[model samples]
Target: MKLLIRNLSRATTEAELQAMFESFGAVQSCNLVKDKTTNKSKGFGFVQMVKNGEAKAAMKTLNGKDVDGFKIRVKRAEDKPTEQPLQDAE
Candidate 1:
């Protein structure tokens, strides 16, 4: 299960996020969005849990929770459709 975490604290690290969710269940992966130029946190990230139930539980306990003065929003991630170019007409 993929979880979208938003409004994360700037100082939040991938490891930190993983640890937080580890209590709920096994974490497949945890990634914290980083600024391309500054190489710093973008204040958001995604967490992947191995089980759907665990993901839901984590969301329930984590959503709207404060970390380092920032309130985090956690929810199931929406799948993004693949983009394609328009076909050329004869």
Candidate 2:
């Protein structure tokens, strides 16, 4: 399951984020969003867990939990809707 983590501290790293979720279960992938120009954390990231149960557990425990002075929000990541090309007028 893919989970979205928000409101993270700027100092938080991908390793630290993975560690947090690893306590619950195996983390398939952990990523911290960064600024393209400055290469700094955008204060948010995504974590992919191998199991849905573990993901739910992590979300339940970590959501609204304070980490590094920030109350992080965790929830299932929603897939963005794809935009369709406009049709030509007759």
The numbered model that scores best in TM-score is 2
User: Judged by lDDT against the true structure, how good is candidate 1?
Assistant: 0.93
Question: Which tens-of-lDDT digit does each residue in 1-90 have in candidate 2?
Answer: 999999999999999999999999999999999999999999999999999999999999999999989999999999988999999999
- Listed in order, each prediction's TM-score against the native is 0.91, 0.95
Total backbone clashes of model 1? Answer: 0
Q: Which stretches in model 1 have alpha-carbon errors above 4 Å? A: 88-90
- Model 1 — TM-score against the truth? 0.91
Q: Name model 2 segments beyond 4 Å from true.
A: none
Give lDDT tens digits, candidate 1, residues 2-70: 999999888888999999999999999999988899999998899999999999999999999988898
Worst 10 residues of 1 by lDDT: 8-17
Clashing pairs in 1: none
Report how far residue 35 has shifted in candidate 2, in Å.
0.2
Clashes in model 2: which pairs?
A: none
lDDT of 1 at 83: 89
